[model samples]
Target: MTDERETVEYDSPTGGWGSLRGMVQTALRERPSAGAFETLRRQNKAGGFMCTSCAWGKPKHPHAFEFCENGAKATLWELTRYRCTPEFFAKHSVTELRGWSDHDLEHEGRLTHPMRYDAATDHYLPCEWEEAFAAIGTELKAIDPKSAIFYASGRASLETSYLYALFARLYGHNNLPDSSNMCHETTSVALTELIGSSVGTCVLGDFEHCDAIFFFGQNTGTNSPRFLHPLQKAVERGCKVVTFNPIREKGLIEFISPQNPAQMITGKGTEISCQYLQVRAGGDIAAIMGLCKFVFAEDERRGGTLIDRAFIADHCVGYEEFRAKADATTWDRIEQESGLSRADIEEAGRVYVAAERVIGVYGMGLTQHVHGFENIAMLINLLLMGGHIGREGAGICPVRGHSNVQGQRTVGISEKPELVPLDKLAEQFGFEPPRDTGTTTVDVCEGILDNTVQAFIGLGGNFLRAVPDQGRIEPAWERMRLTVQIATKLNRNHLFNGKTAYLLPCLGRSEEDMQAGGPQTVTIEDSFSHIHGSLGHRTPASEHLKSELAIVAGMAMATLPPNPKVHWKKWTGDYSLVRDLIAETYHEQFHDMNARMFEPGGFYRGNSARERVWKTKTGKAQFTAPEMLAATNVADADGRYRLVTVRSNDQFNTTIYGYSDRLRGIEGTRDVVLMNPQDIKRAGLSAGQRVTLVGDAGDDHVRRIGGLEIIPFDLPDGTIVGYYPELNPLIALHHHDQASKTPASKAVPVRIEA
Candidate 1:
């Protein structure tokens, strides 16, 4: 009865007495005070709703639990009490809910009706929401809408990602695959080819006026723990920070700012990096070409100027092919592929040549890997070799993880190549749209392994445990003849069922949408682009749920077509006419974006690289080169090891909020892996033993996803680490990130066996 792989390993923290007994069993299982102060007075005020966890940037005041601990477990998992009925999916079948665990199918609750997957009683029955939108609009209008894909989920809502990218370009198909193409598509294709905007040109008061921050491959107090109170107030106002990261993240080496009430009443904890380094997980493009080859040899041996040579000769453009590829990258191949030490990249390039102002922050650990867009164009060529692009505390930030996924690729959820958002959605919905370039979560599971993607909808993620060869995303989600989803709670991609699936449910950004013209607010852009306005306060846990803008206007009114071309049921019954079609297709940046999203804390997005004004195409800011490749998970001629995949301060993104990973003192257990006592005596294994990692299991392969333990520590030699979507079946969705396909889930290549 109870053993959905020990149901989210209870309070799972596998180390120091399971993180002090899972923080005294989450403070004696809390409760009583469920009124979460009217959901924290509807977050960022002026209505409310946007904190579905991390993409931080919003507190210009408003504390008292201004959320974090993964935004209060995404606010008690969108204020859960747990639901899921239709007799709990006609009593659990899809082969016993495909052996559970993804925190036991999101702690088995919150989903109420509109289901489908019958496959002759393998269960999940209740259909009828217009018969599961006329059987998903007659099997996606008999396929070939480039075989239908769709996807999305950064917990949608910029009016349901502009009505699911205008109902997947009015069902003709630009596939729309999302979850930011398996996380930060190399920071939106390397900040749109170096500063034409793919987002993050500083904000959050540019981490309180930089003067060196750096941080690549982010671990910001376990992925944005309220960005450790603005990086412990930029290290108590002496600002330096540093960090690189291959693993040394004890919250970037010491951080204890429980929102600094005098360092959480004197248990004191503010010593966040004044230098940490580590490097080597795909050595951030040889540590940004060894910090731009030590800022071009400290501008040729301290000659007074660290190469901003008049902002690279007036705002840049291949400074002579970026100074002949930063003087053809040497420092002994950047200290032999950045394991760091050319006097720690000349002492972090002498603190980025005595910082006048720097920023750099990064994440998706430098964009998932395999030279993630030349490790984000070598951290924008070490912040444009020190002139640090576009002013006010310098630029390039990228720390986004859904809190509006870079405003769903800035209000058009692109797959764009010259489908220029299907020619601005056929000049705002009249027709001729779907120009093609579709499929992308790894080209929709390699277009469902060559049968060419036969209809999958998704809209809210966990798509087969956030894709990347989950045995080829569970048989390309059982060669789907329609797979739907839309969800709120209940996951493992709704038991990966699909010879026709559905699911539906919805409404959670903390409830209360009401609609038919009453209380409805939504916006959300954040990670420093701002935007705001969210509004849900309780109610609607179920009166048969709904609102992801009424199930994307009831699946674009039973899969569009009849009288379509945009009215989509009066723009889903008013979301200020989906912010007046996002203020008439980004009218010089959402004009009055629904009257400045009702004021309070909402609106920012102007950023011409925050004033250095270089929206590229040779207008300025361009220093691009990135062609290094050739480092496939090193150490192998019989030495094995590489691995990487991390994340566990009670996880998020592949949502497992417990079973203890309180800053790497593992608990309950996520199998464990760490390693490095001299690569466990150079792979002769042992320190708790039990191994078996092997690799390349591409499409739904598993062979031996057995138990592991290992531990050791200081990690680097020929590395290893573990933890992502539980070692994403040892990664192999064609080993990703070739110019931003993303999924190199941190380096990979394995062979631990034992």
Candidate 2:
């Protein structure tokens, strides 16, 4: 008999263990012993850490080992055995490390000590913690704080986020650009316009009571595998789950519950969505418009309580204007714009009409466009028409990407909106906060390009890789006077040259944070308003590494003079003190944060909109009609396809854990772009042909990548999909959402050539 291991080609996409099923089988075949399982169980429950992969909601009663494949990889990465020591850095120069891929940099292991890049030696030399902190403090103090940017990552705990915001305000700058600005800025912008709040109105319990679910731009199966259970429960209860996305994901269509014993044993999966619609890329606004048009028309014809006339009259404003505009939209125009038949839209409207309680869930796909805000607003309008708000199982749900990103913004991580937050900063901290609006993520890059931003302190993030226009961003990063990164592991952002760049190794969430006194617990806010406590399981990987909260406090203490008015050092030792300060500074919702967090599944932040109590000036939900704009990209006579950048199942934003995209049948490669077979034939190109894609006009932005076999897909005419970071160079920096300054990553016009 042939040896199973010898017969398997582990490296090859097809010949080896490329398939997800095959990978799973191999993993089980070479399974670790019971001791390994026990260790994993202990580590998973340890106080301070949460899964770093997808922001899938945590189960109320989490299993001993409840993480997914990507989640496990992220956990192992954080709890890795390897270390990036001074000796390792001495052996490799900056030039040598710069040539490393994202995976290679991370695989080199966790950073063991604080290091500063030496231009002469082109190497990262170890620096003492005190010296590193002093250098960062000096650089920050030198810059006009308004021009200094403090960027946050999603992985940061609430304690760290609150401290970062406090430090930024204390330093006289409100230029707090965070990861949320890139992902969910549109959701915040839209929700505020419609309901006077920036958060989702639904909790996990709301899913149990929902009659119908309209999911858009998110693949719950891969992005948030934990959500599959709730979706499966909803499906079992006869709830209709509808999907609207550019790609038909398997997870959306069918979900195999890892926790379900019978289903797992039988190798059977639960059907997730009752209906799946493959909407065109950047066509969400059009699809939403079409749905509204159909609903309004149906309501008018049905008459007498068909529309929520009482709710519209009593609780909402601008319905007359919205109704008129929606009525004016023609069926033919809707079909032309959305690439969906009028019959299909009306059928979806029938689902909404039949259900008394409905919820709409969306992700970054709905937010990363020029008309993202409008797209979300339209969905809110749909929910309002059916009187879905303020009821159980009915509201707008924006599936946030980062675990704690929503909480970060909730605790005041923004460059705009100068209201109570600024006033509170002055009243509490005894410093007049900068009134002038500061730079956002896009604005920071623009400021860097214009030579205005002198210093950049990234609390935690891969800014260069995350931002658009890679060609311009690389040079702009190098131009900064000083760049400081507080990170646990090495990433591509560290390679971006600066006159003075320092990498300070910090403690991961999974590690214990024992300060001068004792063990510590950090806080995180879920997709809903509920805040929960987290404690670390394992000992600190290195004694030199500090908790994010301590690092922020240390930097603040080193930079600012002693102020008798405010007690900054007290917050460094205990997170509860910081929470108390937060309550005092922002008296809205967090007044009892300290007392409330002690309870299991902490209290809701109290969204007025969720209770049908609008906080807007008029005390009513308002609707605004946005003018429909023509397609930004016009096809050239040469028939170049419009290229759109998207994420794969195995990837999370800029972090590529692996190269296998199981849903799309893409394995071990990121070079191929999914294209319709009709487009390939029309362009006189065959499958597996190497092509060079170029932007319109004299923009020298071009990407030369090979083509894979053309699968006859359902993508709309004049559209193509490819992976981001690689394709970001082709998208112009100026093409962005005007309202929020988010890059129009969803829509970029391009021509493919052989």
Candidate 3:
């Protein structure tokens, strides 16, 4: 097939007229109601709905137009005029809709009614809310509680998440898994073990006081575009910015703030990173260790002045062992594993050493690996060596992709008992909550394959599309006895209906939710642990739609036996009661949630690390030192490229807004792969040649994808990049972080085929 492509070097800086054009184009494409413009004006404001995109923190005093271009796209996508009513489903059968692309399916617009699948007609027919709830309750009651899986997406509010978790536990099961299991589970595990906190220590204001910022594996351009303003401010103040990744992401290089009228008029952008180091995929452990090695050597040269000797002596433990491991690691080994030379690593290290206050930032690129846990641990070790954390503008920031992923985890959407506090939960909810561990995202897939998990309930996510090993999960998903999805729009996952399947529509975050107490507000936590309330001003898309809180409560009311202790109906009627209960459950952080949310920027849940009060067993910050220098295996000595999954500029999670990846200079296509120019020649392939990618998991799965055109670019010799969810099929379900169970999507072994 001939290549139909337009791949060129992206020259312009990120967030200039390009962003302005995107915002206007998306608004026109969605053709939202007149109220949509007013909705955009209030985004991220004190009394407005939170941007349903990345989990970046909102500023204490937000500007007039506080939302980013991508955030506007998300709002417009939800506010589209098109509706997927029962009439639309009648026209297209499930068998036929399965052939539709993901973007096409969702672009059809918001779901208007609760519908159930009809196997005879292969169509979804509208059903009453009462009937749908009764059917789900009957199926759930027939199965063992352990055999049902309750999954949630980060789009849910904290109140809804708290209710979802309580319902699962009350049903005598603890299998509650959400989006966090796939994204920042490694950060939660590593931080909890070492520093006694699972969230970042730096607030949005920290950017003002920092001397340097080091970025690893995070692409702020598409993932968290709102953060570019802070980076731009840091650069303007002469704060050193360094980036380490396999690809030179455009956002890290330069940015033009749309808020800056002068810069926007001039079309001039501020340069972001002072140094860009292209590290190999899954090589963060080695790269971080090299920084530690350099710091240790510099301290030796300065007569022990470079390292924070006093802070280390007072606040940290296990330093001697970590230093010894760094001393023993050879420069040649570090260079080989990191895909960076000694001089480059040292040059980056010099910036870290010179800055008294620094921030280390990263995203899924570092966490979605086989040794993801160790990668986070090694980063902590590097910060501990310099005593960089717990100070002004100095800490570790794990940039979350979803809007409230961190908030969901903060409010008991976890499979682990330790994270959720099962014992206290049992006391409050009046049930014997299960003490045993529950299934994670990976475990849910395994259970479905084995037929041990017979039922599935999803809250606002396309589970089947976002997971790995789609070939294996898709077939197993059909064998389930029952599946219920509470969502706003129709996606590919909704098409794979089980024997008894129901698609229940919920209110979007941009819509006003009216309860008995009047229009209610829901709260979400940002990446920095700032808890704030989100209030929507627009009208509902359909009169039949219900809020997520009501749907979760309705499911619980129908499924569980009558119990006076739990006020399911009343709690849903007045959401403030839900917040009160949550406050009772977690008194320390959420004592007065309702009142505090009215304050500007809400409240900050102070980090223990920032207070210098460690919650570890030893009562101090701990340094993790593993015997081996590299956490995970690198690329094969033979010729094989490490596969890295990425997202397009116009996408959020699995939802595709458009086909254009503006920063990469690709348009109107997703079926393409970016490869190193040298690697393409070695594989006997030319640029723009249609080729296939075969997975090398050392198994008999025959995991391969075809019809992908190759685009040559300047990157590491043995690395290739492809869009996520599309390339998820190549990653084995079992290939995940052993400690956190996050899929190692960053460094899958693969080969190119013609």
Candidate 4:
């Protein structure tokens, strides 16, 4: 299998015929019909289902074709012709299907019925919805409330997530872990502590008027193609883009809009990055520190006129602490640590000085690290130094990875009681929520390992594969007494059977949601504050499949005491009631969720930062003092490479579209490590040589990923790149950001065994 696949350098820009070709092929294989294209036309449109791909917002004024290649694939994959019914499960046991890859499992098709694992045969047998809910209730009643963990995915809508929070708490457990803990946990931790809210301050419209954009640790071309449009427009208006990453991603360099007819005809792509700096893995803090030093030097040279003196005096705190940290750090230290020259760092500062309004964008590259929280605080320090936020076209933007992950958090999927205040919810729902703290994804994993968590119910995600140190975590996962997953398709997590397991199939986002109260439209929050109404019009894969909201409500109804304080059935059948309850719970922000959802492009969930109103502990936008990048996580041995897990253009999170990574110019394999030519030659290995990648995470567990082919590519020294989830095994379960508890998947120190 490794011998059949070969690497090829893609000469074309990101998103032209290559995007079109990939989109068409994926769609044809999944859902080959005229109806499929029609359904896609509504994707990200005025009143259509939001694509469960990346959470890049729909443009306030969208183009004719707003959907990207990956977005099309994401929705169409749900609308596939194939369906995995009861007969399909009866044919294969969990043991027999253990060898199948994640890609193959998903491609098998959408799940069509509820199933329970029969331990005798090691196979899953179909069960009634009532039976599944009863089973969950029986297990919950048997186990201690503290022993249960409820996990949520990013794609969960506001209504469903709100109910999930209520259900988990009412059933007497405070353990609520969500997908953000796996990806953008640092962003939330930094922003929530440093500023007030975890969500970004900027809106989607900021791209048009922003003078400059600094893309740190993000590849815009592939992860967020819809964002490229405004970025292209920004470039046309002379907006400079500066990128800091370990690899030269084609998207960050140049992007041709596949939706633009003129660009397609002319074959000319827009230049994306004015400057692209290849900083090493785990070097984000130092790189950001370099920018801060330059900004401070220029401020002194210009006699403080370069910074917003008035804004700083009026609305910020801790400027002195931030300045002191910057003053103590030297340029020589910055250069050595950031892997960039002093001149390049100053050049970045010069661009910042020239632009009046700046927009800073980042991704998991900055978040999933040992010092990830510090990395974000430093970026905010740079932004606050210039008084960039709290104004038009100026704020921090963290591109989210899923459809409604932001929305889910907004409606109370947080483990922190402060974010989802128990007092406020109790007043709204006539029930008091637990004031105690809950477990995060990392915490839940530890809980499972210690046997503290006996039951886990997932609300729409492949929980096992989405987490780190799966090799160690899976064994603990198997020890659980009861495990339940509410999903649209089959995933690896379903194979991990516990004493009792249930896979309850649910409706996808692109399917018709007709209920007792008539058709319903769900709302989702984007990377920005925009709320979009998603309406699905297609027929479901099976008559047995239920909506996520219904499934969640069913479980709540079965578990909670009879004649409960909250009416679960009334709200489940009528989504408006759920929206009404959400609005009541969060009256200040979502006072009229149902009414406002009907707006043409929906409305923005109010952002205080956007209005220059800080809501932090000090009631001001506080300037944070961040420490120097920690070298503690880096391996001590010489000639060791730091391996960062990355996503392929063809994939979305844990779902692998194919083996191809078109944006990075690789093809036909996920089990390949991208390495610097110098490092490759130093190890006495050439391109396509197979080697075992071993990791040292300061633990007793031996971490190794074997049989990975090496591909000599454009990566920084002492750094290598591998596909996400596949490389997740190398990351220790304990390895994570200290403050946020986010897995440090971006900075695993390793050596290649040839």
Candidate 5:
């Protein structure tokens, strides 16, 4: 720990020697130094692996050092020398291991072989790959296909996810829920409805041309460091970057590129945000509404078409409806709900209007709310009003964290079967797939709780930690008839064993996957719609480890009765076959997928929104009057604070890199809650005082997470922040975006337990 007790620093920029040192320390600790360096150099480059940590698009012209700190961290972690062999598991019982932290569990090292939980021994014993697959197959085939859940984590490749999705469909189920359900599901839900696609309209080149970027509820620095490169360039080019979040993030403020040798030596950084707004948690809709009101009022004042009347008339719908809603939204209400003054919002509005090319960027902050879908709609509404869609430098950018969360959906990893191209699937696979909608993340969790869902097959991701209300979900998962996690590293999820649970070890993105057709390359879709190939730069962590693609294929072959139509062996042997299947399915977007994947930076999956062509029912980019659900609920409740779950700087999704959040000046702890000093005093508590957070959303289900030490933080008066997974218990499982079924993890009504 730093000598400075409870240290808090401000105005520090992200990246620098610190990031370099972090990368080195992690590498030395987890993997061989030489191998780690080679892997880092190879990240997101030609003939190297793409980072699975974030889906931030790559630069067209690469820098000397392409990868960022977290990307390096992810690389080192994936290529770790530490292995959890059978001997390791034999020493620790599930109960004993359950007491360990999520960090300690993963840090114990990667699973080296397929292991099945032996109830008699209370330990995971090594099992033969084929035997393990046979057991999993038996469980899947025995259970009702509708009751079985195939949970993808978005860490898998497009080919792997496609095969998994197909396997599930062939088995007659559409329960293809993924990590996107927790994060960018709201983005998908909004984009699909508004623009006829679920991906961002902008490409990486757009950043070079965009005049301004309005950052909504995302900490791009920590979550996506590669973004800082372009963001810094934008700042240097006099482009505006505005930010809105409860707590200010260093990445949004300034950045010193770790890759830049000059900056690394000089310790200088670049400023990013021209304007920063400390929006209250769940206030995105109000903030956008405020921005819209200014734009509308300005156009009215000008009377000579300041609101892009031509674009409005030709390219969009619901203008008058959205405009009236914007007008009806009072400045007082906006100020109160958004925690931003009318003048400040108008200043942002001015920036928005002045910029000819504007790009709106957002992440879970805008989408991880009860009104998350509405928040996205409002953001899109802001873009549509400015005629920002389908332009070279303008569009909505949904910054997905997982490498291929977007690709997973593109390859048919969706619960909504309506989105699936059933006619193509039937033509290609000869299976009349079930048209019925299956379980989503929410439904799967509900099913687990109610004991309706009996079996679970997780492709990747720490499912239990990532989900809300883990306290309830974990035990429910333990009660399942069968659970299989095809994973690289051990997580908290692995500890919660079902009656028959199996941990099937798989290859990481950095590891080589050699099948009958020799080494394989997988495809990942970036935040932009660019589809690229990633070739592993390192050898396999263990010979026993299988590709997620092969594992899914093995299970599919074993589970399904022998059929000529489903050529599982062929797909397993040659991944190109899987790519061929994708190309056959979505011929337009993935045409010549395997061939195009070999292109320098892969190919862009065609998004209709990018061409100003909306595939909507109304045949235009439809403006939406999103309900002010968050604003209506922003009324101050006595003894309550809007507690928002956030990630520490050292974390990636549920994977805690370490205990420190360097940017936040928080260290050596995960038990503290970030609160405004005024709110602490209002609650009759002092800084460093401990309190129990009692969830107060409603009903008989009272959630209490105790022993949280309050640390005074810079944020809105009514908003409090806590690092997630620990605070996951405070969020209700059912509390999610109604349209997207995404957990409302950002804001929850909570009070000090009295």
Candidate 6:
């Protein structure tokens, strides 16, 4: 906790020699097995593995080095030579392993065999695959299906998710929780209500032709580095890239494409954002409403020439109410809540009005709050006013984090029965799927704490580490009757084995999956809804490791009684068979998926809103007119500062590659807090001083993390920034979006203790 704060100023733009050096350092540190780099070379290419870092779409003609620095790190981490075999587990008991850091737990390396927890020895002993499967099936059969939760992470492929969904449904439960529930679930709920589609309508090619793009609450460089390529090109082509974020992210200010040899050699980079507005944490709603208010004022001054009156009359509803709300919202209130001047908001509005085509893009920053749904709804209102919903280069784009999170949702991983086609699944599989709505990510934590959830099946994720209220979830996790984890590497989540827990090793995305039909190619859907095939070129880390598809099949085959319709063995042998079933279930969107997946750059699943086809209840694009405009995160008490959790450059979601945040001029530590200089001064604290952050958890209980060094930066007053998972404990489980249940990680109220 007393880690020294080594502030290393990184003056250069992101993605130049520094990025290249990071990639090289990652490769050297991981010490990957043979052919790892060779497999990485083919990433995002035709017949290549998909990078698991982010869901950024690949260009139609991908560069030779399509993978970014974090992508390379993910590949190397999976393909590393370090192995956590039974012998490794024998050396360290579960109690001792709990004392290890998350990085050390994963750095120990890939799990090589299936292991079962031994309570007497406090160690994980190697177990046969059959024994693990039987034990899981026996426990599952003993408990009511409603008492179990089937959780899927983004790492699972479309085939594996489809099979897993079917298995969970057949097992007579709708308790399916996924990573999306904690991230982009608000996107699904908001977009579906407004535009009748859950996914983004924009394609990767749209960025090239768009005249302007409005980015809200997303860090492009760290979360999705490959996206910098398109942004750099857009800047080169004179497109106005406007950004609204709490932090003055380095990537959005300027970017140098490593692919551009000339710029790299010259040490110069293209300016990314034409204007960057440092909005306060959870101020996106007010900021977007301010833009809408400005647009309405301009349209009135121009005699309605600026607003798309015809499009609104023909294709949208509730405009009159939305306009009334915008007209009632005053400039003084907007400026105060958004932490920006009226002139700045108007200037950004002028940029929007001048552009012929624009794309409204966002990330979890907008979707992980109490008013998450409203935040996105207001953005949709802005886009609808400009007629940006259905156009060649204009639409909504939610840049997802995980590689296959969207694909998993598309393939029927959801807690809402209404979102997925339950009837079709039941009819196709010859069993009635549970129709009742199921538990979400937050609900799962509550269920576990109450001991109502007896068993949990994790497809591929560190569930305990990723979710909020980690301090509460860990002990309850151990009380469960059974826990099954299908993963590739060792993580902190693997150590918390319940009464009966099994760790099943599975193939990574960069490893070969030789089925009975020969080498297999799995499919994943990007943030843009483009479906592409991924085939690993590298060998499997261990001969005993099974494919995720196989592991799900093994659990299902062992649990369920022999059914005439279901063929688990055949489906596991050939993934295409699973895809065919998916085609039948989601016929309109994924019809002929097998054939279309082989097409050039794959194929888009198609968005209804993109074609001006609204499938909402009103049969048109809908608009939400909130009664009032306010900042989602507000100062309820004196000295309470708004805290936003973020990931470092060297880390992905819950996966830490290194301790440094190179882009932010910090090195050798992730425990430092970035605060505004004025705020630090007001709090009677100085830079490099260690402090504790206590959350406003709305109860008598104290939730705090101590020994975090404070580093003064250029952030807004009453706003501080810290790393995620580390700060997750301060965020209460109930502090989340009411509609989506995504934890409000972006805006938690806390006070500093010197």
TM-score of each: 0.35, 0.92, 0.98, 0.98, 0.97, 0.98
- Provide backbone clash counts, one per model: 21, 6, 0, 0, 0, 0
Candidate 3 segments exceeding 4 Å error = 1-7, 629-631
Compared with the true structure, what per-residue lDDT tens digits does model 6 show for residues 582-691? 89999988999888885556688889899999989999999889754543534456789888999999898888998868998888888878888777777778788889
Candidate 2 per-residue lDDT over residues 692-715, each given as its tens digit: 666652365543444533333446
Candidate 6 residue pairs in clash (backbone atoms < 3 Å)? none
lDDT of 5 by residue, 161-268 (tens): 899999999998999999999888888888899888788888888888999999998988789888999888888998999999888889988788876778777777
lDDT of 1 by residue, 181-282 (tens): 887877877777777777788888777888888888888766776777777777788888788887877767776545455644565566778889887677
The residue-by-residue lDDT of candidate 3 on 514-633, one tens digit each, is 998899899999998999899988899999999999999999999998876799989988899999988988889999899897566668877888888888888889997865554455
Cα deviation in Å at residue 193, candidate 5?
A: 1.2
lDDT of 4: 0.85
Clashing pairs in 5: none
Give the residue spans of candidate 6 off by over 4 A.
1-9, 631-634
Q: Name the lDDT value of residue 640 in candidate 1.
A: 58
lDDT of the candidates, in the order given: 0.73, 0.73, 0.88, 0.85, 0.85, 0.88
Worst 10 residues of 1 by lDDT: 1-10
